[model samples]
Target: MPHPILETTDLTVRFGGHVAVDHITCNFNAGELTAIVGPNGAGKTTYFNLISGQIPVSEGRVKLNGTDITRMSVAQRTHRGIGRAFQLTNLFPNLSVLENIRLVVQSKAGRGFNILSMADSHAELTGPAYEILERIRMTDQADQVVSELSHGDQRKLEVALLIALDPLVYMFDEPTAGMSVDEAPVVLDLIAELKTRKDRAILLVEHKMDVIRTLADRIIVLHNGALAADGDPAEVMASDVVQEAYMGRDLEEALANV
Candidate 1:
């Protein structure tokens, strides 16, 4: 309803003859946590790739804050206040938790003029890194090398690192991937905390229905590369079309149970 932070119009992506994403349009509002959910091969990830400029659009436009950025490079998008994390955690395994975050903060500080200067000595960057870790409740592990951290701790650290970028919109592709059931909660908690902040928009591509229901202010369901359902979680989850597409016979039964 309000001015959208990110939006797509007739967004489509194709690889050769196969259409991975059809002409679909959606908007992610600022300060909202929106989940894009669908069965496997539903073009969820492809849509993310399209919006983040990881791949060129076959046809369509992606607008960030009313500016056309469909053709922008990944770096351009990041500098324009878009940040993304993969299903697999991306981090420098050998670096200490604080160092990894400090690197991102420093890079974003626009001080390439001092590239070779002692990064650790840059209190401006390190100060924010610790503040970010503390926000995610990972401050205690700030000095630990990433390689020694548990799978759950690493996931939290990855989120901590992303927060240091201070992007207006963040795209998280399966942030809970590769974690044990117990570990998944750590990632979920971090995401939950992020949703409370009103400074940015967050889009998540996730299969975990429970997590989706918990975090999404809105939910978009994709089916075979097209927009299937878009609305509140209860409405979308109750739709017969979405049920049949994703839950099949079990879905109808699930609705009845509900």
Candidate 2:
């Protein structure tokens, strides 16, 4: 078999004596969307942190296309093709939406020094930035300061930032956390669109079973920081292990509620 686009071997992290993310060994491949699900505090996000280099690995290694990146910094991992979107908005508050994306495009192109000061003259940066904004349907808000944008719009912009980076791995922790039902589908549609590309792997950490049911190609259950089940979305979501791991709201209840 070919190598997975991303792999974690015994990945773990400890906060003093507490093992936030226990030994989690999993492989993620391109052209797939894996939804990491478990009860709150199950360390799903911590696992993402370990893989994305937001936290150091206490005892494991993360690989991208077979390259060990366990010791790399967050920026290094991002440059190496790991793109992460937070549960909360992570953007340049003072800058316009266009400027926010333009900076990332510039950085990805190894021309971050342009720094939006001479942004108008840098078509190389703005051209791609505009394209990403258009893709996310944020072209109208291009000149609005990020701080001034609504929470839902800010969330959309964050996804746009990830798109601008164009990484091999896309990590989204509850991509629709604070958006209204009306606003959520725009982001979900974009995720659906991204999943079409065969070269990118999308990792989503979401509790909305409906979203998971609709977006996940595979579902991985994490309980107490350890991997519990991994397989087809329908099968894994119904497995005894998954039912027990998600006792807070069993699959049946989650599905019924949806």
Candidate 3:
């Protein structure tokens, strides 16, 4: 088996006297998709922050490919191959879809800040940028302003930007947070395709059980700032602790339909 691309040892996060995340340990292996699900305030996103360097760990360590990165800055982690798509849309609304992605490609190449001067002249960036657009099925909307695209397309664009970074581990915080039913599948399919790569590790914090059921190879359940269950999706879903803490009776109902 391949080594874990990301791992945490007794990871914890504290806010004042409150513990948002307790001493939790988990490993995310390459070529796998792991879903982290829990009730609200279960420290799901907090755990992602601790690993992504959005927030510091109160105790414990985050390791990427066996290297301790507990103190790495967000930018440093990004360069070290940790990429994230936030629960909220984070994109330049004013820029065109192509421009938004090109900037990331350029940044990844270590170019200086020259958005205006480089926008028209950077053919090197355009090739890879357009390739990403094509992969995301947004090539037709390349020149369209990001604000003008539908919310679902914008979300897909966000993932595309992450693909441009080509990180070893991808952390998605509710990639389908606020989308209509039709829009939800578009983003879901994009995520599904990522799972086929078999060369990257994907960790997602999702509330939607159907999405989790369909995409997750493994599931990690969190409750009240601690690890509740971690195992195969079927086994984890059947767990009484998970059913009582979060799924309640709906899990059985949902599984029956599946």
Candidate 4:
């Protein structure tokens, strides 16, 4: 088995008196897909923030390929090979899809503040960024302005931008949020394909159970800032505490049918 790409040991995050994420520990292995699911306010996003360096950890540590990075800044983490996509669709509305990916590649190349310079000066980064777009099957839409693309295509472009960073572990916070059923699978498929790469691991914080069931090798359930269940999809799905706290009756019924 390959070494885990990301590991959290007693990771905790506090806000004032509220503990948004308790001492939770989990591992994300390379070439594997892990899903983190929970009810609203269960601190799933908070946990992502800690791992991605969007916020500081009050206790515990986040390790990427065995190096502790609990105190790293977001930019530092990104450079250390941690890429991310948000729950909200994040893209420059005025820029074309190709331009958006180019920007990400340039940023990851440590040239984010060179508006006056030629973007082609970093052809190495831009070339790989274009390749990422092709991987997500968005090359045809590369020249289209972000605002003009469909919601599904925009989500694909968003992931493409992250792919351009070539991170070891990618954190996606509800990549399908606010999309119709028809639109959500487009983003989910993008994630699934990314997981197939042996060098990349995915930490997915998502709500769609059907989508989760299809993609997750392991599932981590969070409730009230603590881990409620952590195991294979079948085991986590059968957990009564998870069923009640977040899975709800629909998931229970779906589990029964399965």
Using TM-score, give the best candidate's number.
2
Off by over 4 Å in 1: 180-186, 250-258
CA lDDT, candidate 2, residue 91: 89
Comparing candidate 2 with candidate 3, which one achieves the higher TM-score?
A: 2
Per-residue CA lDDT of model 2 for 37-111, tens digit only, reads 887789988898888887889998899999999999999999999999988788899999999999889889988
* Predicted model with the maximum lDDT: 2
RMSD of each: 3.0, 2.0, 2.8, 3.1
Better of 3 and 4 by TM-score: 3
Evaluated against the true structure, the overall lDDT of model 3 is 0.86
* CA lDDT scores, all candidates in order: 0.83, 0.88, 0.86, 0.82
State model 2's lDDT: 0.88
lDDT of 1 by residue, 1-258 (tens): 778999899999989999999999888888899888777788988898898888899998999999999989998898898888776777999989988888888779876579577877888988988888877777888899999999877877776667788788988888876677876786688778777887689998877667776888888889899999899878887888787766674432442343
Superposed Cα deviation of residue 15, candidate 3 (Å)? 0.5
lDDT of 4 at 134: 73
TM-score between candidate 3 and the true structure: 0.91
What 10-residue stretch in candidate 4 is worst by lDDT? 249-258
Return the lDDT, model 2, position 46.
89
Worst 10 residues of 2 by lDDT: 249-258
Q: lDDT per residue, candidate 4, 28-99, as tens digits?
A: 899988898777788988898889988889999999989998888998899888988877788899998888
Question: What's the true lDDT of residue 204 in model 4?
Answer: 88
Write model 3 residue lDDT over 1-258, tens digit each, in one string: 678999999999999999999999999998899998777789988998999999988999999999999999998898888999888889999999999998889879887566567467879989999998887778999999999998888888887788888888989988876677876786788778888998899998877777888999999989899999999999988889888765576554643432
Error of 3 at 181 (Å): 3.6
